[model samples]
Target chain A: MSRLLESFRIALRGLVANKVRAALTMLGIIIGVAAVIALVSIGEGFSAYVSGELEGLGTRTLFVWTNRDAANPQQLTTADAEALADPLACPGIEAVAPAYQQGATATYAGIETSPNVSGVTPEYLTVQSYDMKVGRFIEQDDVDHRGRVAVLGSTPASDLFPGSAYPIGETIRLNDVPFEVIGVMAEKGSTGPMDNDDVVLIPLTTAQTRLFTVDTVRGDYVVSSINVLVQSEDMLDSTIEDVSAVLRERHRIQPGDTDDFQVRNPSDMVETVTGITTTLTIFLGAIAAISLLVGGIGIMNIMLVSVTERTREIGLRKAVGAGKSDILWQFLIEAVVMSLIGGLLGIGLGTAISQIAGSALDMQTVVSVNSVGLAFGFSAAVGVFFGIYPAMRAANLHPIDALRYE
Target chain B: MIEPVIDVRDLTKVYQMGEVEVHALRGVSMQVMPGEMVAIMGPSGSGKSTLMNMLGCLDTPTSGEYYLEGAAVSDLNDQGLTSIRRHKVGFVFQTYNLLSRTSALANVEIPLIYGGVPRRQRRQRAIEALEMVGLGDRLHHQPNELSGGEQQRVAVARSLASEPAIILADEPTGNLDTRSGKEVMAVFQQLNRERGITVILVTHDPDIARHAQRIIWVRDGLVERAEQVGDRILADDSQGSEEDKGQAVAVAALDASGTFEEVAS
Candidate 1:
């Protein structure tokens, strides 16, 4: 124990004698550890943000879209959507909303902006978990009567009316077709690649007959997609199966053939995106780990140089009765001390950098305890791994040859 | 009869220099009784340094039986040789070999540290060793802060701290001037006479060789002759007697002139 303490003192003195070289060697480890922490924190924050966005829509919600890649492409209709709402047909399903959408420029007071013009029923708000900001959403009476009424999402409302004037009771033009704006929706924000707030909602009947007229193949209006809200989170999988069965029967898909439509669970998408993001995080960490590998090499390089420089010292110590293990431990401890100190400083610097970046980018950054432990442990391992060769080189030197080293 | 401090019989050392074998020592035999100060003198390549290394336990002889303080050393393993060196042998080098940035006291404590001496006892012994070499006041000074002779004295103190049975000095004052060399020799002689410690000096200088009670001459890897000096030169006028106060004053005077004469001469 006393000999070990003495070796520590000797190692410390050796490092202190060459301050610049020692500090430079430690810089490699510092940068490597810092990069690992900062990049990982940012990556973790991104995945968390995406998961939160997906959770906002509710886990029980599922989206069904027409699959254009099917051998016989099928179009989803309002009739098929209505059929899914039958309680006996889909007991797990609570509500369903059918929607058709087209991108067009919206104009009010000569200000023009692009927004998705969507035709949806009143149940769209319930199924999508959206609340009204001021006035009521589209009702069944408006669809039956084919009333030229519209509801503005928060983004289109702001775009059409830059001033704080009430958007209700105002007339807006969509693709040169005028419609009365009856209500302004609350903010739903954006998720993935689609912006929920950049939309203008109208009655299904009015949009099909007046603005976007299509040839009636089966005397039914077609919708782009259908959103189904399940009764509970636990019933979501059964509800998706129920909806898939309904759509498959409606599209006349054969038992041996693939379905012409796809039912998507929002939670599944969250899992997949989270998986991708986690992979991205690990890839970033591995890239940072390459720098750590280089840092280990740097330590090895410096230790080798130190061994060569202190050959005479090694000889002198051996002459004074220091054993091989003593010399080996001395050099090994010096290397570990350098890397461990660098790891600590890197953690502090990395945490600070991540916090600053998080606030600047307006995103959450998490510096988990696991990442800190991993980085610290890895740096120590690197010290031991790299320190071995040089320490052995020093220990194995014949005392006479070492003393004679010029 | 007192057992000899060192006993060697037909010791030989052969070095493999790539494709050639160089016989450095060939069947050398010698012994030194306890408390005797002896010098091994030879020109370069005469195996004097190799013999010193063998005696110091830094290297094992290729062939023969050797014993240090009555224990057989020729067949010991590396660990045993290190243990023998730690407990029974202390080495002083031509270059002083003190750690450059370390204090004189710390340098002196190194051998004791390797010997696993307790910290307090190590410090006490180191201080005593420094005072033994007349450098009690220079303990905290680094090798760079002290003169060449002072550094050599620190090295001597380092060797003495372990309380080894024998001190092997290889050209101990080679780097110092005549004054520092005489001071170092005086320290060795005083340690031999007062503490009854056995000391061996390896040098080619006749002036340095004459300070020892006996001289062993080596030529071409073999001992040429062994002789006793009729009139040996005392390194200092106050060396033969126990005069601590007078020796301190003389050391103080030498300390003042220690660095000056080396630069001038």
Candidate 2:
């Protein structure tokens, strides 16, 4: 320990001897470490942003859409929805809400606006992960009785019912027929290319009978899209398979013929998106790691210069009975110290940069503790790796030659 | 009757500079007893430095038997040579080679550090060594802060710090003024007389050589003459001794007459 302390003192003295040169040499290391941290953090933030956007899609929700024969363009129906909701055939399937969407004009207080209106069951809120801020979603009684009721998303509610005190319970005319607003959905931020909280919801029966009135609905009453809620995430695959099999049999598709419905597993979507994010994070990390490599090279360069500058000192120490290992360790310690300092400074700078980016750009920046560990570990390894040549040079110097050096 | 502290028998040193070999020490043999003060006097290029280097264990002779306190130093490796240099010899270079950045006290403590002395004990010993050389007040002063005389004194103190059996000084007073040279010579004489440290000094100055109890004059890598002064003269009736005595008397008379040719002859 004393020898180690003495080595530190000697190294410090060497650095002190050439203050400007040493500080300048440390600059490369500092910048490199900081770059590693900052780049990785930003990459992490980007990935986090992507994952949070995916989470907006909700968990345990499955999307069943019509698998159009690119040649045929077939739509799904209410019969397919009923088959998907069969409890005995598809156990653990919670609720099946079929959706039909159409662009239609909504009127309130002499003002008219065209918005996308979706017809769905009450279970649609849970399946699509919607929370109502005021009033209630379209219920089973509303669907059975074909009541002329509607639910507004936050944006459409404000747009259609301007100056109204709480748009809920107000009547909004869809295509000139008055429908009472039963609920207003809470705001859901943009996910990828979709603004989820910018539309209207009404009972499927009401939308079918009043809005797009066709008594004997053809093709699919469900309008080619259905949202399925499974009892748990673990039962999702089986539920999808069960739903697909029932839809195929209902559509009368023979074996080897393409089915008319497409099952989109939300978990699979999450996995694919998460995989992409993870890969992107790693790619960014690898780029950031280049800075670390540069930092290591900087350490090695500085150590080599130090060895050259302290050649006489090394000789003196050896002449005074210090062994080869002692000289080696002294130089090695100096390199390690330099790299560690750089690593720590980099981490601090990186975190600060990440925080600034998170607030300024409205990104979700997450600094994992493991990344810190990895950065430090990498710095230490760099110290050892870069220190080897200089340490060897110092250790190999002859005492006599060193003493003779001016 | 004391054992010889340094015993060199037919020591020869050859230096290979490119292709030509320079025989620095062709064949040199000598002995210095404990407490003896000996001076090696020669002209420039007389190989005095090479001989001094060998005695200091800083260089090995090409072929020789050098028994320093009965241990063979000629065959020792680098580490062994370092041990011999550290524990058995203290060297005072003509240039007063003190580390410029270190204080006088710290410079004196260097050998003790190499000797594995603990910090506190080494400091105390260094201070005592400085005091012995009358530089106790200049302990904290660096080599550049001190005069040539004081720096040499610090070097002397450093030599004494290890408590070695032999003090090897290569022109210890060469760089000093007359007064400082006398002062340094006085210290060397005192140390030899009081501490019983064997002193072997190399010098081209005859005045400096006069301070030693014995003088070994070297010419062309050979010990040309050895003279014992003070109390080593023996009362003898041998013819060769009588002739040497007559020559000595004639030289003394010429010195009284102040005749350059007579003294030179």
Identify the candidate with maximal TM-score. 1
DockQ for each candidate?
0.61, 0.16
Runs with alpha carbons beyond 4 Å of true place in candidate 1:
A87-91, A103-115, A133-186, A210-215, A232-241, A254-258, B117-123, B144-147, B223-225, B228-265
What tens digits encode model 2's per-residue C-alpha lDDT throughout A168-251? 778888888789988888887776667787788888877877788533436446564888999998888888888878877777
State the lDDT of candidate 2 residue by residue for B1-265, as single tens digits. 3456788877888888899999988777776666778889988788887888889877789997899988888999877877876788888878776776879998887777667677799899999999999998999999999999999999899888989988999999999998999899999988887787888899978888889877777777777666655332221213224335442421221122111111212
Q: Candidate 1, B72: how far from true, in Å?
A: 2.6
Candidate 1 lDDT over B70-176, as tens digits, reads 88999999899888878888899998898987899999998888999998998999999999999999989999999999999999999999998789999997898
Per-residue lDDT value at B47 in model 1: 94
Q: DockQ for the candidate 2 complex?
A: 0.16
| TM-scores for all predictions | 0.86, 0.79
The deviation in Å at residue B59 for candidate 2 is: 6.1
Docking class of 2: incorrect
